[model samples]
Target chain A: MPFSFLLLVLAGLSVIAYRFGVSRARAVAPGRQAVLHSRPMYHGLYVAIWCGIPALLVAVAWVAMQPILVKGLVMGGLPDAYDALPKARLDLIWNDIRNLALGDVVRADPAPEIQAAAETFRRLYTIGNAALTVLCLIAAPLAARYAVRHVSIDLRARNRVEAAITVFLVASSLVAIFTTVGIVLSLLFESLRFFAKVPVLDFLFGLHWSPQTALRADQVGSSGSFGAVPLFSGTLLISLISMLVAVPVGLMSAIYMSEYAHRKFRAVAKPLLEVLAGIPTVVYGFFAALTVAPFIRRAGEAMGLSVASESALAAGLVMGVMIIPFVSSISDDVINAVPQAMRDGAYALGATKSETIRNVVVPAALPGIVGGVLLAVSRAIGETMIVVMAAGLSANLSFNPLDAVTTVTVQIVTLLTGDQEFDSAKTLAAFALGLVLFCVTLGLNVFALHVVRKYREQYE
Target chain B: METAILRDTMHTLSDTHAPEGEAAPMTAKIEARQTNVHYGDKHALKDVSLDIREGEVTSFIGPSGCGKSTFLRCLNRMNDTIDGCRVSGTVMMDGEDIYDPKIDVVQLRARVGMVFQKPNPFPKSIYDNIAYGPRIHGLAANKDELDEIVLTSLEKAGLLAEVKDRMEAPGTGLSGGQQQRLCIARAIAVSPEVILMDEPCSALDPIATAKIEELIDELRENFTIVIVTHSMQQAARVSQRTAFFHLGELIEVGDTEQIFTNPKHKLTQGYITGRFG
Candidate 1:
């Protein structure tokens, strides 16, 4: 039977089980619902879970294991001569057999022995699926009947259902955590491979970065340099410029919106300001590359000063504009969170409006604002599209905002976008960059959390 | 000694006795005549008239939503902070119309300080919390003078001895009673002519409430004090005069002893005797 058909059958059985459980509970209680430990709805849900969960698990397991089990059975029945082939050649033959079994066009006409193996594979797969359908058909009804029999006045149907829901919620959260760990582990392993070719200290501390390695021995630029210091410096410089622009503008705007703006104005204006954040970063990239970069270069030429066409200033300025809503929204919330009582205390003491906000409200909201700014700084450092389009990929170890620079993300994108062997240091270097970026942002987030925690205790 | 005087006054309460029968003829430090307050469409405070005498604790007592707190906030124009709140009629402070256009609100607030229901200390060191008012008003000429003002304010609020060693600690870190006292000290540091307290002891325990009540009695020696309270016994203990409000109208105003013992209005009698509010 098809998987969808099996699912539909399981669903139908669960519905029947639910109705049976509800009617059975009612029949046992007659007119005494108060005597039952749980309501009729919980009893119904409990029976449905018992009916559906076991059959669903069996179907899922069979679907996962059928191909491997069928292939194993087919291989055992094959001729002994096939076992002596190398693993790669055997894998090619297995691929051909699978294609032939599915009636797909194969590379060539197969031998009679291979053709027999494909037929055997097809037969085994059919038998496994048919058996799964029969077993599920029996398992659902039997489990549901056991549940119905157990549903007495003393049964804790609510507790059992609640426990099952809790297990589901835990499983959902664990998937996210495990995926994050899986990504970090994969990055770590690939970075180790890259480090084996290049020393860790050299990659971390050396100033030069030229990642092109010639495939032919006689080709130019054969000796590729993998020093990452320039990328780090460029990332830091752009992030610094962005923060310098973002912090004051964002914090002041937050203060104005939270403390000064009229209620109707604030209601309309806040979402409009957040619209800047909602604009796709890719759009911001083109805006930087096409608009601001040329403007800065022309303005620099008018001043009789040298400026790169793709300068860090343009990207940094645009990135800062992108981050304003992030800082402003979080700061605005924290500022608004500062109790009205604090402002009242200041105003009551003969202090002016400015004094109240400066001495009391801002200080009370400082920890949250600091946390927001740090998060924005990390976002600026990791931002790829804006820096990629506007900040040229030169990797210049310069602090001047007028000069072109390439960040870690830009370098990673440049390294991995083209056709390249997976095992080469050039391709694996992207994973190494990814690992370092992850660690830096993780450190920043941890530090921001610490600052918020330490200061929040005094207020609470 | 205070309780003896309170008991003696309660026993002698009569309608014939003059309201201001004390040896010294008191003058009104703050006076309101036919004052009305509205929040949006709601008539929060009706045309209420009262006198806050100089160097006296006059408590406003009523049930919740009776406009006692609203009247207290109106004294120093704290209502201005609230959006859509309108106030009309005259409020004269020391014979000057406080609602006049020329009067600077910032300077007026400095002269008429306030303490809130809950302890709202700035998230600053205890010393800074007290010195903030003086520094902004430029009351102290130097750092030593500022320190002196902070110490004396704390001393007057009865919090100096306990917190003298930790002036650097955040005021919010103090206990509930201590934080409230710190707020009182902060108000005192400005040397305001009047202090308005809106249910200042409502959030406190009995012991903290008692301390705040005692502090209010002491503060009355220098600053005119107007307090709004829910506890009738608290009004009898701390206030020299009491005003009862019901449904946004001033029901009665008299000497605290007379109001508690021989209330003239049936509504005042009903509220004071716990018959109904």
Candidate 2:
């Protein structure tokens, strides 16, 4: 049966269990619900939990194991020559058998022995599903009956329901944790493979970064170099330029909104400022590449300075504009969080408005502001689409914002986009870049949280 | 002492005997004439007029929201901070109208400092908290003078000996009473001519309140003090003159002894005798 249909059947059964559980408790209490220890709904929920959980667990386990068991049985009954075949060839034969059983068109014509195995596979699958349905029938009613029989004035149904919910909540949280672990492990494994092919030292400290390897030994200009120094420096230069643009503009706007703006103006202006954040980064990328880059090039030439058409300055400035809301919104919250009492104290001291904010309010809110800026920095570093479209792909290890440069995200996208073998050094290099990017962002987030938490402890 | 207590009680029960003369000399430091304050059409203070004598502690005693604190805030233009709050009529300080547009509110605040009910020390070192007012007002010429001002202010507030060793510590880390004293020290550091305290001991424990009371008594020797108090006994203990307010109206002003023992108005008599708020 489809899992959704099975879930619907269990839901119907639990609804019945809930009705029975509530009526049973009422019957025991005779004419007075006041005699029951817990609410009627809690008792119903307690019974529903028992009826649904055990049957659901069994059904899930059966569904998970059914295919593996059926495949094993089919493999065991295969012809004697299959044992002599190589593992890959045997895997192809098994795939044909399973596809034939499912009544899909097979890739190849099946021999008589494989045809027999396909019949056996279909029969086993039918029997396994039927047995699972029967087992659920026995389990749900038995658990529900037991729960209903145990219902009394002293059952503590609320406690049991609470415990079950706690377990469910924990399992939900573990899903997020396991997904993160799985991603890191995959990155680690692929990067290890890449390092085996390209020396780690060259990837870390070497100055050059052309990943095109020579297919022919005599191929000219294809001696691929994997020094990541240029990419790292390019990332740093762009992020620095972005921060330079973002911090002052974002912070000043935040202060004006929080301290000076009237209620009607702030209400309208804040959302408009935040709309900058909601504009897609791809749009910002194109804006940088098509508009800002050309404008900067023309302006720089007019000023007698050499500037690349696809420059880090353009991408960084556009990215900075894209991230203004991130800094402004967080900083607005931090400044607002500085208590009215503190402002009152400063004003009562005869300090001017500017003096009060500078000497008292800003100092108190400093740690949270720094933490917000750090988080914005992490956001800037992880951004890919902006840098990919505007910042050019030549990995120049220069600090000049006017020069063309590429970040790790841009290179990772370049390496992974085209058709290529996954096992090659070029493709695997993407995973190594991913691992480094993930680590840096993770460190920044952790440090930001620490700083924010420390600031909170100061006031409260 | 027993006979005096008996006679005071006898005088309080029958509100006919006029009490002794005013305890302080008659010299008005801040005089409000027919001051009417409105907060968005709610008449918070209605045509109130009173004199705050210099070099003496005067107390405004009233029920909650009786507009005593509102009248007190009007003295230094602190009401200007509130949205939609309007104060009319003339408030004269040293025979000059303070409501004149030429007068800077910042300078007015420097001359008239305030202490809130809750202890609110800035999130800075204890020394810095005291030095903040003087530094902003340019009361100190050099670092040594600044240091001397801070030390003297702390000494005046009676917090010097307890915190002398740790002037560099954040002012917020002190105990509740010490923090209140620190705030007092911060206010005095500016060398203000007048100090306004709004229920300064309301949040404090009995001992802390007693110490603050003692400090208020000493502070009156240098600066004119205006205190709003909920505690009738605190007003009688620390204030030389007392003004009784009820429902945004000043009912009577007299020596503290007379206000408590022989009130002139019915509302004042009712409030003092615990008949009704």
Candidate 3:
């Protein structure tokens, strides 16, 4: 039996002990009520967790080390015949033996010594797991008996239980923070490796950005430049255009919903607008590429201006349409949250409805509105699928939206996609771009949080 | 049970309570004739009739949700903001039917200003807070005139000297009392004929309550003031006339002295003597 299974049986016995303790406390202590010290429910839960969590934790520890122990014993038992083989062949034989012990069907051939080692591995697993479980089961009930008997009137069992819950919550939160740190460091490490091979100055400030360096030093026509300026510039231009399309339209819609529209109209329009945000970015990508790009091209042709088929304008406009609900929903909430007292105050001052909204309501909600805008901007910058599908791959660093351009996200996708070797600078450049994007978004989020906090202090 | 029918019955009941406040010795500023108020199917104010005298402090006292605030709000058309609220009969201001379709709510609010139960000052500079009403109505020609209006209004509310040096500070930074006074100043800035207060001292401390009470006494000489209060003693001290309401009906109306000292209806008797308010 595993340590966990033994602990599980101990946990059941602990509950029985807890119940006996409660009945014993009632009988010995001379209380009319059957319950004493803590509530019956709390007592049961307390004993159960004590019997379970700690011993189960040790069971986990024992399980983690089991493979290492089994491997060691098998290696020590290997006959001298196996030791005579080459390291590769010996490793293969050991691998086969380990697999055979686990009852896995492995392809490699095993010697007589390897087979003997496999038998020893199975025997050790049975002895170790069963011994651990049986020992834990006996230990759990004894501990439960001690804890239940010691629970006095002054003992803060509830507080201890609450503290345990708090620890669990903190641990879960630490996982998220740890994962974020891990991702950042991974990006940093890969980006640093790429920077070592390609100059940082060139990657950051060079005008030409084409990463097609050959593995063979003497190979002809495989040399490449690695300027990231074009990608950055393209990202900025596209983001600006998206904001241009999204901000006013979304804000106006929010204002209409909050102020002018009736409840019936608001109920219909708000969800319809939110549906825009819910549509997948892939759908947006296809719409931008197939429908919007050609439209922009023809419209530009009519105006006698040349327009690329995969123009940033097309991609940005579609991206803007995709993000409008973000602006509308958040702004609508902020605007609606502008207290009814504020509106009433303005109205009572001989101010018209529009005047009240413009001077009083909007000013109160300004910080929230700014924070919403920042969130929208960061979303636009980090957006990948739409730009990847619609925006062209060529890094044309220009302010003109009608030109074909590429963002850092699009390049990052193209750089690492397909079966590329991880050690290559091209693949690692993706991590460098990811690091930059993460920093940008993180900064935006922090700034937004600050603004929102300040806003809350002012109004709420 | 519908609000419309309640108002009709209230008009008949109003006669018994009509002469409560010395019959407005000067003249009636705004009079409600057989006017009733309702929110959805709930009869908030029964067909109630009363005269708000020019330059006099009149108060309506009642238990919680007894429509004291509802009646005060009707003077300035503030109830228009509530979706299901309906008013019948007529609320006349200076012989004009304020409830008529031709009347503009914004104009009515300007003519009849209100100070809410909670002090809600605009989150702007002290100067701008007072200047808001004047600016919206275009009461001033230039920055100098606007500055003058702000100072005069602040003076009227007795907040000018305290806030004079810190005119640009955010109005929200002020204490609860000062914020209420600032709201008062903002109301007077528009120079309305009447000032309606809805339990103005409910959110204030004792000292702030006394100051506001003093301001109300002084304001009675210039503006028609109607205050709503759950506090009977405060109503007795400030208001010349007092109206007692019980369960959406005006039980009695009389001079504060008479209302406090004498008995009229069983409900009114039950209320003042602390039998069951």
Candidate 4:
């Protein structure tokens, strides 16, 4: 049977088990629900869990083991000469046998022994699936019967069902945590492979970052420098510019919304401000490149200043606009959370409205604001599209915002895009850059969380 | 109970003549004339008129939502902070109409300071918390003068010795009673003429409440104090004159000893004797 069809049968079994469990609990108690340790639905859920979990586990194990067993049986039946072939060639032959068993035409005609081995493979698969179906059919009813027989007025079905759910919840969280661990390990492995080819010091400390490695020894001037200073400086410069733009504008707007604006105006304006965050970064990239960059260039020429068309200023400005909602929304919440009693205390002390806000409210909310600004800075550092489209890809080690500069994230994207060989130092460098970016942003996020937590403890 | 009521009425009638008698007459610090307050459509305070005397500790005692706190807040225009709250009346402070638009509310608040039910100290060092009002009002001309003000305020609030060593600590780190005293010191740093306390000791323990009550009695020597309290014993202990409000109306106003011993109104008597809150 198809996997979905098997799932449907199991679902039907669960429904039947639920009804049986509920009726059995009621029959045991007659008309009294209070005599039962838990609600009737809990007993139903208990039966359904017992029926579904074991059958699903069996089906998973069967599906996972079937292929390896069938492949072993098929290989055992292959010609004796196949044992003499190398592992790579043997894998190719195994693929051909699988294709043949699945009724697809092979690239070339296989030997008679291979064709007979395909027959064995198909037969074993059929037997394995049949046994799996029979096992599920048996296990579902047996587990449900056991649960129903054990059902009593004193049974704590709720505890058992809730414990099972808690295990499931823990397992789901473990999956997410393990995925993050897997990504970090993969990045580490590739970066180690990269450092083996290019020295770690050269990658971290060298001044130039041309990643073109010549394919042949005779190729000239393609030794491929990998200095990260220029990228680091570019990231810092752009992040500083973005923060310089975002923090004041965002904080002022937050104050106006929280303290000054009328309630109706705030209700309408807050969501409209948050809409800036919802606009895709790619759209911001388009606006940065198509509109803001040229305008800056023309304006710069008018002032007798030289400005690159794809300057860091354009990208940083647009990125700042994109991050405004993050800083403002969070700052607004923290400001609003600074307890009305604190403001009242200030107002009652003969302080005017502005003094109360400046002296009491802002100081109370400073830690959360610092955390929010740090989070925004991390976002600016990791931001790619706006920098890619508007900030030029030249790794210029300059402090001038009017110059073209490339960031670590932009370089990672450029190095990894399109067809590439993984064995070369060029492709592996992307993983190394990703690891650095991950570490920086992770540090920032952790610090932000710590500050926010400290602020919460202060008030609560 | 009937004889007690009759005796209270007689005492009130006789004492009514004593205030006007004249050799050294008591003066009104704040005079409210037919004050009306509304929150949207609810009549919170209805046609109330009373006088808060200078150099005295006067307490307003009533159950919850009896408009006692509302009337206390109206003294310094703290009600202006509440949205949709309206106040209409003539409130004369030191013989000047405080509700007049030309009278800056900020300066008025400086003259009439307030302490809230809950101690709300700014998240600053204890020294800075006390110095906040003086620094804002420019009451101190220099750092030394500011220090003097802070020291005097803390001394007056009876918190200086306990917190003198930890003046740099955050004001919120103090114990509940110490924090409340810190707020009181913070309010007094600017040297306001009157202090409006709305259940200031409600959040304190008995010992802390006693310390604060003692502090309020000492403070009455220099500042006019109007307090609103739920504990009748607190009003009887700390206040010279007591006003009993019930259902948005002043049922009786008399000397504290008279109000507690011989309340003129039946509702006041019941409330004082713990019949009903």
Model 2 per-residue lDDT at A37: 86
Give candidate 2's error at residue A407 in angstroms. Answer: 0.7
What lDDT tens digits, residue by residue, belong to model 4 across residues B196-231?
999999999999999999999999999999999999
Q: Where does candidate 3 stray beyond 4 Å?
A: A1-36, A71-128, A145-156, B1-14, B17-25, B261-266
Clashing pairs in 2: none
TM-score of chain B of each: 0.91, 0.91, 0.92, 0.92
CAPRI class of candidate 1: medium
Q: Given candidate 4, what's the lDDT at residue B95? A: 82
TM-score of 3: 0.91
TM-score of each: 0.95, 0.94, 0.91, 0.94
Candidate topping DockQ? 1
Q: How many residue pairs clash in each candidate?
A: 0, 0, 4, 1
Error of 2 at A259 (Å): 0.5
Clashing pairs in 1: none
Q: How close to the true structure is residue A76 of candidate 4, measured as C-alpha lDDT?
A: 76
Native contacts, share recovered per candidate: 0.87, 0.63, 0.74, 0.74
The numbered model that scores best in lDDT is 4
**Candidate 2 wrongly placed segments (more than 4 Å):** A103-105, A215-223, B1-25
lDDT of 3 by residue, B1-277 (tens): 4565455445536557556446556778888877789899898887677777778888999898888888888888888887889988799899999999999999999988899889999889898899899989999999999898889889999999899999999999999999999999999999999999999999999999999999999888789998999899899899988888867767677678888888566566678888876
> What is the fraction of true interface contacts found in candidate 4?
0.74
